[model samples]
Target: MRKSFIYALLVGIMVAWGLNVTALKILVDHFAPVTLTALRIFTAGVVVLLFLWGSGQLRKVSWNEAKQIGVAALFSVVAHHFFLSVGLTRTTAANAGLILGLVPLVTSLLAMMFLRHRLTVFRLLGIASGFCGVVFVVANGDGGLGHLSVGDVYVFLAVLAQGISFIMIKKATVEARVMTGWMLVFGSVWLFVLSLVLEPGGVSSLKDGTPSLWMIFLASAVVATALGHMFYNQAVQHLGPAESAVFINLNPLFSLLGAYWFLDETITLGQLVGFLFIVAGVVLGSGGLDDMSARFRRAKVAAGGRKVGM
Candidate 1:
C-alpha cells in the first residue's frame, strides 16, 4: 500500500479512537464501567474474529504465540480498558484524552528499556516535557502541584499497560489481525471475570438501556474498538512502533474536539498547554522529529542532484 494511504488510515483510526473516549464516558454514565468494558470488548472481539474467518485470515497460533497473546491481552485489553473505563467515569473525557497523549512517550521509554532503543538527550527532554504535561492535566487543570485526581491516576496506569503491550506486540510474529482478535478475546474473558466480581448487578443493568444507548455501544464496539485496533495493528506491522506511535499525537486533539462536540465539555487552558507539551514530547521522544529532519535532508539532496543534472 502507498504511504499516503497508510497515513490517512492512521489519521482515521486516531479520530475514531479519540471520539471513542467520549463514547466511553457516555456508556459509563449509564452502566457499570467494568461490565460495560467486558461487553464492549467481547462484542468487538467477536466482530474481529468473524471478519478474519470470513476473509480467510484466521489461523491457529503456536503455543508460544498463544502465551505472548495471553500476556499482551492482559496488559493491553484487560488492564488498559478496565482502567480507562473506570477513569472516564470520574474524569472528563477531555482530561482522559490529554493524559493518554503520554502513550507515545511511555512507549518510547519502554522501547529504550526493553528493546535497547537509544535514549538520546532529545528523548530525555521529551520524556520530561511529557510528564509535565500529564501533571497539568492530572492536577485538575489548575496546573498546580496539588493532589492528583484518582481518575487521572487510573488513566496513567492504562498508558503504562498499553506501552508494555506495544513491546509485546512488536515481538509477536503472528499476523496483526489474528493477534488483535485473540488478544481481544483473551482480554474479554479476563474483563468478564473482573466484572463478575466488581459489578455484581452490572450485566442486568444493561437490560434497561435505551435503544440509543445500544446504538452508541454497538458503534463503539464495532467501529472504534474492533476496526480501530485492526487498522492500528496493521499500521504497527507496516510502519514499526515508533512511526505508528507518532500518529497517536493526533489522538488527543481528536479526543478534545470530540469531547467538546459530543459531551459539551469545556477545554481548559491547562489542557491546551498540556496538549502542546505532549505533542512536542511525542515528536521528540518517538523520533518523529528525527524522521522529519532526515526526510527533509533527503529531499534537499534529491533536488540538488536534479539541478546539477540539468
Candidate 2:
C-alpha cells in the first residue's frame, strides 16, 4: 500500500515535470532561455538548501559526495536543463515533451554501458517505439520528418541531452549521497551565470510586468522545478530508475492537460498517437509483458487481503 502510494506521488511529480514545459513556454516572452533556467535552478537550490539545513543534513555531505553531486549537477541539472529549456523555447512544449519521452530508452542504453545494467529485449523495443514516435512527431504524423526545422532539430537534441541525464541520475542517485542538494546548488549557480552571460538586459527584465510574470517564475521554481525534482530524486532512491522511468510517460500526458488549462491548446489525434507510442515504449522499457505481469502479481499481493476494490 505504501509503495503504491509513493508510486502515485512519483507519477504526479513526473506529470508536473511534463507540464512544466508548457509553463516555461508561456514564460519565455518574459525571460530569455538562460534567464528562466537560472531562475529555475536557483529557486530550487535555495529551497533545497533550506530543507537540508532544517533536516540537519547540510553538514553531513562529504567532499567525495560533493564531487559526485557536482558531476550530477553539471550533467543532469545544468547541461540538461539549459539545453532542454532553450530547445523548448523554440518548439511547442507539447511537441517537446512528447519527443523527450524518449529519455527512458536513452537512459536504458546508457545504463547498460556505464552502470552495468543489463539491456533487456523489452527495453530495447521500448527504445525503438520511442524513436518511432519521434519520427511521427517530426513527420507530422505522416511517417518521418520530411525536412528538419532548426527548432525541431534543437528540440530533438534537447531530448538526447535529457535522456543521457536521466541515465546519469539513475546511477548517481544509486551511489551518491547528497545528490539532490549538490545538484540543486551547483546547477543553480551555473545556470545563473549562464543567464547573466546570455540575457541582453539581464536581471532588469524581471521588473517588466506581465500579469503572471513573477507568478510564472515562482510556480516554476517552487512547484515544477523544486518539488518536481525533489520527488523524482526520492523516487529514484526508493524505486530504482528502471521502474521509475515508467513514471516519465506521464509527462506528455500532463503537458496536454496543463496546456488545455493554461494555454487553451486543443489536443489532436496525432498527438494522441504520439502519446501511445511513448506509453508503449515505457511499457516495453519497464521489462515487457513478463515483467508487467509480475508487477501486477506483486501489486495484487501488496494490496493485502483486500481485493484492492478497483
Candidate 3:
C-alpha cells in the first residue's frame, strides 16, 4: 500500500512538473518572462512560509546556511528560470522540454568534476550521445548545427546553471524544506529587482490581462510551485532519493505531450529522434544499466539458492 501510494505520488510530481513547462509557455505569452517568474516565485515563497509556519518547521536560518542557500538560489532558481523564461520566448515549449531532459547528463558530468566521482565508459557514451542529440535537434529545428539559435543557447545555459546548483546543493546542510523556501525568497527578490530594472511596466500589464492569464499565473504559482514541491519532497522521504529521481525523467514526456495538446506544437522526426537519444543518455549516464545488472545478479543468486534448498 505504501509503495503504491509513493508510486502514485511520483506520477503526480511528474505531471505537475511536466505541465509546468507548458504553463510557463502559456504564461509568457501573457506576461514578460522575468516579470512572470518574479510573480510566481514570490507567490510560491508565501505559500512555503505559510506551510512551514503551520507545520512548526519555520525557524531562523543561520548565516552560514543563508549563504549556502543564497549561492544555490542564484544558480538554481534565478539564473535557471531567467534563462528558461527567455529561452521559451524564442523557442517552442516542446523544444525546450526536450533540451532540458539533458539535466541528468549534465549533472553527472558536474558530479564527476566537482565531487571526484568516477567517470565510467557508459557515462562517457551517455554524454556524447546527449550532446549529439542536442546538435541534431538544433540543426533540424533551428537552422544548422553550427548556427544554434539564441534560445537554444539560453536553454543550455539554464541547464548549466541548474547543474551547478545541483552540485552546490550537495554541500549545503540545511533542511530541504527550509532551504527551498529561502531559495524561493531569494529568487523572488533577485528576479523582482531584475524585472523592475529591465522590464519596466511589466507588473502593470497584469491589470489589463485576461482571465486565462490570471488562471495560468495562479496555477503556476500554486499547483506547480507549492504543491509540486511539497509532494516531491514527500515522495523523496518515502521512496528515497534514487527511486524518486527515476520519476523525474518522465517530466519531459509530459511537457512534450502537453505542448502538443495545448499549444498545438508539432514534434518533428528530428526532435523525436533527439528526444530518444537524450532519454537513453540520461538513463545510461545515471547508471540505470549498472543498477539493472546488480538487481539481476541478486535475483539470479536468490533463485539458485532457493533451488538448492528445494
| Per-candidate TM-score against the hidden true structure | 0.92, 0.84, 0.92
**Clash list (residue pairs), candidate 1:** none
Model 3 TM-score (2 dp) = 0.92
Local accuracy of candidate 1 as per-residue lDDT tens digits, 1-310: 8889999999999999899998999999999899989989999999999999998999899999999999999999999999999988878899999988888899989999999988787889899989888876766543345766778889989999999998898888877789889999899999999999999999999988999999999999999999998888788778876688889999999999999998999887888888998888888888777677779999999999999999
lDDT of 2: 0.71
lDDT of 2 by residue, 140-212 (tens): 6223366644556776676666666656655553333356656777887988887877887767776674776
Assess the local accuracy of residue 199 in candidate 2 as a C-alpha lDDT between 0 and 100. Answer: 81
Model 1: lDDT of residue 33: 90
Candidate 1, residue 309: CA error in Å?
A: 12
Q: Any residue pairs clashing in model 3, and if so which?
A: none
Clashes in predicted model 1: 0
TM-score of decoy 1: 0.92
lDDT of 1: 0.89
Per-residue CA lDDT of model 3 for 1-310, tens digit only, reads: 3899889878887888888889999888778789889889889988988899999999998899999999999998999989999999988888888888888789888989998878888888889888878876787776667767888888899999988988887778988877888898899899989999989988886777788888888888888888788778778778765567677778778988989999999878888888888877887776566567778999999999999999
- On the 0 to 100 scale, the lDDT of residue 257 in model 1 is 99
